[model samples]
Target: MHFVYMLECSDGTLYTGYTTDLDNRIKKHNEGKAAKYTKFRTPVKLKYQEKFTSKSDAIKREITIKKMSRQEKLMLINKG
Candidate 1:
């Protein structure tokens, strides 16, 4: 299954992304292999995630979430 995931960084920051392997993806983030934005934001925790049947769907959800304001993202995170 694909996943749409949100991470809370050690610096009180938030990041939204998607991957098929949640564990590996988090590992990559920790190891600075995920994205440049997250590279310096080490020790990120997966605060939220949703499984999807398709990668496209997962990516679409990620895009939608990324477009949201931080407050709205927090609300969504709280709701999840």
Candidate 2:
């Protein structure tokens, strides 16, 4: 399975991405080995996650989430 995830950074900002290994991906972000955005915003927490059977679906969902406003993202997290 793949995943589309939202992370709340230490600075209260959000980052969205897709990964096959959710736990390891979050670990990499905290360890400063993931995306550049999360690297600077260390100590992120997983706020939301959605499972997908295919990588393409996860990627598409990630893109959709990335395009959303902060408020929208917050709503999505709340719903999750």
Candidate 3:
């Protein structure tokens, strides 16, 4: 399964991304190896996620989420 996920970094910032393995991806983020944004903001927490059947779909959703404002992202996470 593919996933579009949001993470809340230690600095209280948000990050959105697409992945196939949510657990491992978050592990990489916390380990400072996943994304440059999250690398510096280690110890991120999974704030939200949406599952998809295709990589394309997940990527699209990830882009959409990335475009959202901080308040909007927080709303989405709160909904989750």
Instruction: Highest lDDT: give the candidate number.
Output: 2
Clashing pairs in 3: none
Model 3 — which ten-residue stretch has the worst lDDT? 57-66
Kindly list the per-residue Cα lDDT of model 3 for residues 44-63, writing each as its tens digit: 99989999999998888888
- The digit string of per-residue lDDT tens for model 1 on 1-80 reads 99999999989899998888999999999999998989999989999999999988888999999999999999999999
TM-score of 1: 0.95
Give model 3's clash tally: 0
Cα TM-score per model: 0.95, 0.97, 0.96
Per-residue error for 31 in candidate 1, Å, reads 1.0
Pairwise TM-score winner, candidates 2 and 3: 2
Residue 3 CA displacement from its true place in model 3, Å: 0.5
Candidate 1: global Cα-lDDT?
0.93
**Model 2 error, position 11 (Å):** 0.5
After superposition, candidate 1 runs with Cα above 4 Å error: none
lDDT of 1 at 80: 95
- Sorting all predicted structures by TM-score, with the top scorer first, yields 2, 3, 1
Kindly report the root-mean-square deviation of model 2 from the true structure over all alpha carbons: 0.5
- Which clashing pairs does model 1 show? none
**Candidate 3 TM-score over all chains jointly:** 0.96
- Candidate with more favorable, higher TM-score: 1 or 3: 3
